[model samples]
Target: MVNELSSTLSFPILIGDIGGTNARFALLTDAFAERREFPVVQTADFPSIDAAIQETVLDKTSVQPRTAILAIAGPIQGDEIPLTNAGWVIRPKTLIGDLGFESVLVINDFEAQALAVASLSAEDREQIGPGAIRPAASRVVLGPGTGLGVAGLLHAQHTWFPVPGEGGHVDMGPRTERDYQIWPYIERLDGRVSGEQLLCGRGIMHIYNAVCAADRKEATLETPADVTSAALAGKDPQAVETVSLFATYLGRLAGDMALLFMARGGVFLAGGISVKILPALKRPEFRIAFEDKAPHSALLATIPTFVVTHPMAALAGLAAFARAPQHFGVATEGRFWRS
Candidate 1:
């Protein structure tokens, strides 16, 4: 796949950022040109990847792109790409031929996000902690969206490398006594506690339910938006508490990912949930939880964290790769693509 796709670097390549709920597509026509305007299409509205592309992209673009790269919300596994949260699976065997593209490169969404970090400016993100990104240093990107996505980026010899993994599924524990009390209830649902169990959008509902259960209260929230709305309005104390715990748990996982990747370049947070719950994340509790790792407490404090606000970050990253494949250390070797 590397040899096949790597040799096709050209102008006007199709670049897409796909997730469980939304799909965004753009055309990168030049090395430094701004990402071409694109639209956000609902994932549920389209039955398959090719259908989504044909309706939202192919019919709209006049460039007639022959090559493409897509950043997906799931693992880019062999033959088939399985989305962890949505009911979509990308089968490369019949996909490219159907799309009428010469070849296509598929990658993890967070990996594309990690690639976008290379070109991010101050205005592109909001800082949550107190450290700066070191030039050419290793950085990590993670987000709580339809599910939690994690990846690391490193630079060596002018090439940005993306290390993708299912880090969100790792077993996690609580820090506070309140957390201890509520975790038992959450544990009953999943049998095991992973970061995604209580950090993503549905995770917010889980935390809200657990908090309500521990307080012997009823759950009024049915979705993540409801939790955020009720909490921000101060209409529901349980929702407020749930968002607080959500930040702490997210901070914990973000800090852990930073440590695992030695993300001295900084940690970039993405996802729909993170953006919607910005107020809770800005509180001191989030920072405290992030820097709470003892012994390395001071070390974690030195790593900066930010919330990605750019809607097209993953697309931008994929654009960078489509512009110059040699500029990234992306895991594409031995990867397969059908045409």
Candidate 2:
């Protein structure tokens, strides 16, 4: 149950989407006003999260945010939340004290992204296939960035609930000849390949290397950007093949996740990488792979897929939580104001 005070957000609530590389901030004051996007901050530029926020938020606005919600990368457990891909450790109490906020919320990045699905407008997202969102049904968000992130959202009891987990770490192995060929390359790097092994930034590099080895070509690409740029421009055949397989594998995994949650509501292709490779994702291979699952192929095909184009989607999700805590499966205990 929400206390009378917790039932509504304090004015000018602060929402942040903190990632491994960049930290995005937004301010939600007027419910009717469009959410303002603050300048993106480099995570490496600041020594701590608090310092970054202090410089980017408090110092600029000159107003202490009474309520704050943070969507961070990694699991949300205990007092100190360690970022999976970053060196930052978020301590809610420290932030509350330092920022002088009455409440603070820290949630897994994907969980927040999942919640954003409800808040996203038509312009905020781009549909990848032919289908419409099933009203009030389960929805899931998955993305390939520095790491793969996954989460689901369901509506029950008149509230949108976020289901967060480490689904990205699940084992992913060879399913096709191309995948089998890539396995040996991945094995050489991380002994055991997880779903993120071939779907993430470094994964692109890995796939590029595997393609080169399989075809006896030079593994000239050094970074994920290099591979993506080459593939997009058709500058390198191996790079192009790497991206194709990446999309194919990502589609299959997305379909599996859809079955897991029965996410008829929709599946959002979030994260920076998806936006960068929008053209590639639009290819038929992606939709084909997503709908290739037998016994449920038709069902999966009916479930729509989209790439989240809005940069501040997580911030919007946080804002939604602040407006109505009951709308999410979030619990308020101590410094944990939102899940």
Candidate 3:
């Protein structure tokens, strides 16, 4: 009877999608077709991911999962990775031993997010411009939010594989006289400027300052939300120019990414800013800059672009990762993998 009851009780697994500021939790209840099911809890309510899982499982029901998967913000190299913006240092083996789980998988947050793009259906995506999608070609996923995130995916043997990278740290170059002027202006504040410098939330303010400096106006540092508010109200010229320049740079970077990967499958723009400033992205200058890649401009025009509307798409990728056996290849003694 005990064996039958154990078989009947599904693997109430634990899954999480963590970022700089928050860690989201979900419960995968069933063993069969479990990834399709959605069970989530906000990270703000709990102090840590482990605490969140423990409290959630206890409050919901008595189901102990033998396996857990957590996707966190940072590169996965060795056993420990300090979260980009948080103080916690995640050690895979330590957590696994502490939790008494048979298996625990940790992956790059952006890689986990990339895994979901191909898995997402038509309903989850929205068109940003006119371009064709070549499903067999390489696809690029770049987002500007808490930080600039980049990842690439290749489709092979009817399966999608994610390639994690630190493309955000790539140097930012100027393509025009205006961009040239802005580039040097930003250089004054930063000795070595990366795309993340002007592509993230703080990046909006940097662009705004650059525009202000170019116009020989006094610059005032402000938060991303404040600048967006002022721009939406049409009350601040600096904020207005900031958004315009930001969109243009976004287009340029997207084009560059497309060129780098020959991303014929598609180029997706994600992050909190894209969704918040959807109206601004519709401007002519934005699309024009996106397609203005000099000789390769023609190729850029043919590549499809989009903004993922679903807030929980990354979590969906976490679910997909949990379902894929290849994601967790060989188990090791300490924490690192050999294959």
Candidate 4:
């Protein structure tokens, strides 16, 4: 039975999944079983998350959500969160004080995503490795998009521990002569090579340029969408090679993360680019590169790999965050709900 508070507070919850490119807001109608419930409003149409929330609440429904949780693509410390990729800086206290939300929670975008992973279903997950999840093991989550986001989930004391890391900035490895050749190309731009340099949308373009440069072909770097479309249409050889290499690098990174986190639960590939390259990622070369780790190749192969197909994974995560006991339990002090 739903508690009186849970039932009484059920107008809806305002939740946000803010990233560098967009800020997605949603109304979580059902607090329980959030894995399959909620409706999201596209953030691109709105200037800011606050505006989106206002418009959504005003235009969509009259029910006022007492709680708000914002998962941002930047660090959340104290009252200020300036977006890493956008021009918005938010203060949670201001939202609670001005917006009149009963409570507001702000966390790292990947951290919110990690929380949602615990509630993800088999149908929601697209496996990357061959190993069956051990039912009760740690899982790591990573996505390649505007930038790379990394986090891990460890089951502890009946709740999932969200351990966020700046793993995307970690230096990547070069397994092939071609990879070694391209490494320097990226190094020329950034003093050091990070995984984000070679695995995101612009990363795909970078890879294409390096490949064309290596082949001594004059190349024009195109936008990610153009390149992906060309590769999908089989009209551009350089685009094809660039996309393939991007997939390979992603696999290698996933493999390394699986080993580091002992992610026996699975390796989830979530992001705009992964969804765009789903057809190519299903190819043998991508799978081969993911399992190419020597000595521990078998181990890498055993970890299940998946592409997150849900467009609302982050929104679902926000709903989950609102209900998680560790987050909302024992609200006290000047916390919005308590007021």
- Candidate number achieving the greatest lDDT relative to the actual structure: 2
Per-candidate TM equals 0.94, 0.93, 0.85, 0.86
lDDT of each: 0.81, 0.83, 0.72, 0.72
Clashing pairs in model 1? 160-329, 161-329
lDDT by residue (tens digit), candidate 2, 166-248? 88887777888766766676644356778888888988988888889888888888999999999999999998988898899
How many collisions between residues are there in candidate 4? 11
Segments in model 1 whose C-alpha atoms lie over 4 Å from true places: 1-6, 30-33, 187-190
Give the least accurate 10-residue stretch of model 2, judged by summed lDDT: 330-339
Backbone clashes under 3 angstroms, per model = 2, 1, 0, 11
Candidate 3: list runs displaced more than 4 Å: 1-10, 31-61, 187-190, 218-221, 326-339
Residue 133 lDDT, candidate 1, scale 0-100: 77
Select the stronger candidate by TM-score from 1 and 4: 1
- lDDT (Cα, tens digit) per residue for candidate 4, span 1-339: 113334434335777788877667777655564432234545556676667667666456665667776777876655666876676777766676666776675667887778778777777767653668876688888888888888887875565677776788788767788878766665333576688888776677778888888777877756888888888778888888888888888888888888898898887888788888888888877778878889889887788888887777877665765665454222222222322
